[model samples]
Target: MATLLHLDSSAFHEPSVSREVTAIFRKEWEDRHPGGTVIYRDLAKEPLPHLTADGIVSALAPVDSHTPEQAAAAALRSELADELERADAVLIGTPMYNFTIPSTLKAWLDQVIIVGRTAGEGGSVAGKPTTVVAARGGGYGPGTPRESFEFVTTYLEKVLTGMLSLDVDFIIPELTLAKSQPQMAPLIDAAEASRAQAEQDAVQKAKTLAERFAA
Candidate 1:
């Protein structure tokens, strides 16, 4: 049976666009693979520690030389990497915070992006299909005034593709705050349309991935 590693980092619960879209993808995935396993991590609820200097040193040092604290940090990193290594696919729900991913998500990435374990020639999750649902509160697509401010998807793409060598796909829902913010009221229609399209694409992508991995 296939195993999917699912990560959600949205602080907001029901109202979060990223979470909503990711739910669609998860539903489709579960429907396709009823017997498959899903390793779910809600980063917002259980935040990971940011990489500290000690943790970095421990990751590079030999296991036998690790201090108590270093060993604990190394263990956390290993656990995170092991989840990715065992998964056949990955799904991430990330809402843009100040034009980038939340600190919770970033912390998780720091824990998992180990050198030989997940980044180099022997990367465990290399070439695995990874889908990222990136939700932005404002419009930052190409030609938009804030286009250059969009860093969430770009940063994730670079790390997941450039570093880990994963086959990454992005599903973006823009202007998610349109309905909630008075200043964005006029853009609500466009936001809804974008959300609908993202949901549809996520479902289709899930089906395609399920079939590919099932085969």
Candidate 2:
């Protein structure tokens, strides 16, 4: 049976574009694989602790020499990384905050990025398909004035691909604040279009990956 590791880090539940988009993708995936497993984590609700120096040192040193605190941290890191290693596909939903991903999501990344374990040659999860839904309040696509400030996708692309060697793709719903912010009122139509396209992409991508895994 296929396993999917799904993560959502949006603080807002009711009106979060990233959460909504990710939900669409998850539903499609679940529908296609009734017996499949989905390992879900809501980072906003149950935040992971920021990676400590001890956690990093524990990975480098022998496990038998770990202090109690280092051992605990190491265990947590291993557990988190194991989820990724077990997954056939991975999904991350993170709304942009101040032009970057949420701290909760970053913490999750830090905990799971064990250099010798998950971030190097012959890593357990290398080449896994990772879909990231990066919802943003404003447009930051290429050629946009804010494109230079788009750290969410740029940073994640490097980390997910360069560090973990995962095959990464992104589904972005931009201009999420169009309806809420009066200054963005004129962009409501454009925002809706982006949302619609993102939802469509999610469903299609999820279905394709589901079939690929089921094969």
Candidate 3:
């Protein structure tokens, strides 16, 4: 049976566009593979520590030379890497914060992006299929006023595709603030349309990917 690694970093459990869309994908995936395994990680509830100097040194140092703290840090990194290595596919729910990914998601990336493990030659997760549901509160697509400020999808694409060599696909729900912020009231219609389209895309993508991976 296929195994999926699902990560959600949204702080809010309800009314989160990223979580909503990712749920659609996950539902479709589960429907396709009823007995398949899903390893879910809620980063907001159990956030990972940011990489420190000691953690960095421990990751590069020989296992035998690791101090007690270094060994602990190395172990955590190994666990995160193992999750990615064992998964047949990955799904991540990322809500844009300050125009980029949440710090919790960044911390997870730091833990998993190990040299020779997930980066350069012999990378464990290299070429793994990954789907990212990126939700942004404001419009930041091409030609938008804040286009340059959009860093969430761009950054994830760079790391998952460029760095880890994962086959990454993105499902973005834009202008999510339109429903809650008074200033964005006029854009609510467009935002709803975007969200609806994203949900549909997520279903199709999930089904297709599940079949491909299960085969």
After superposing candidate 1, which stretches have Cα over 4 Å from the reference?
A: none
**Candidate 2, backbone clash total:** 0
Candidate 1 lDDT, tens digit per residue, 1-215?
Answer: 88899999999998898999999999999998999999999999999999987779888999999999999999999999999999999999999998899999999988889988898887878999999999998999999999999999999999899889999999999989998899999999999999999999999999998988783
Q: Write the per-residue lDDT of candidate 2 for residues 1-215, one digit (tens) a residue.
A: 89999999999999889999999999999999999999999999999999998998989999899999999999999999989999999999999999899999999999998887899888778999999999999999999998999999999999999889999999999999999999999999999999999999999999999999994
**RMSD each, Å:** 1.0, 0.7, 1.0
Write model 3 residue lDDT over 136-201, tens digit each, in one string. 999999999999999998999998887788999999889899978999999999999999999999
TM-scores for every candidate against the unseen true structure: 0.97, 0.98, 0.97
Which has the higher lDDT value, candidate number 1 or candidate number 2?
2
Model 1 has an lDDT value of 0.93
Q: What lDDT would each prediction earn against the true structure?
A: 0.93, 0.95, 0.92
After TM-score superposition, the amount by which residue 53's alpha carbon in candidate 1 deviates from its true location, in angstroms, is 2.1
After superposing candidate 3, which stretches have Cα over 4 Å from the reference? none
What ranking of all candidate models by lDDT puts the best one first?
Answer: 2, 1, 3
Note the clash tally of each candidate.
Answer: 0, 0, 0
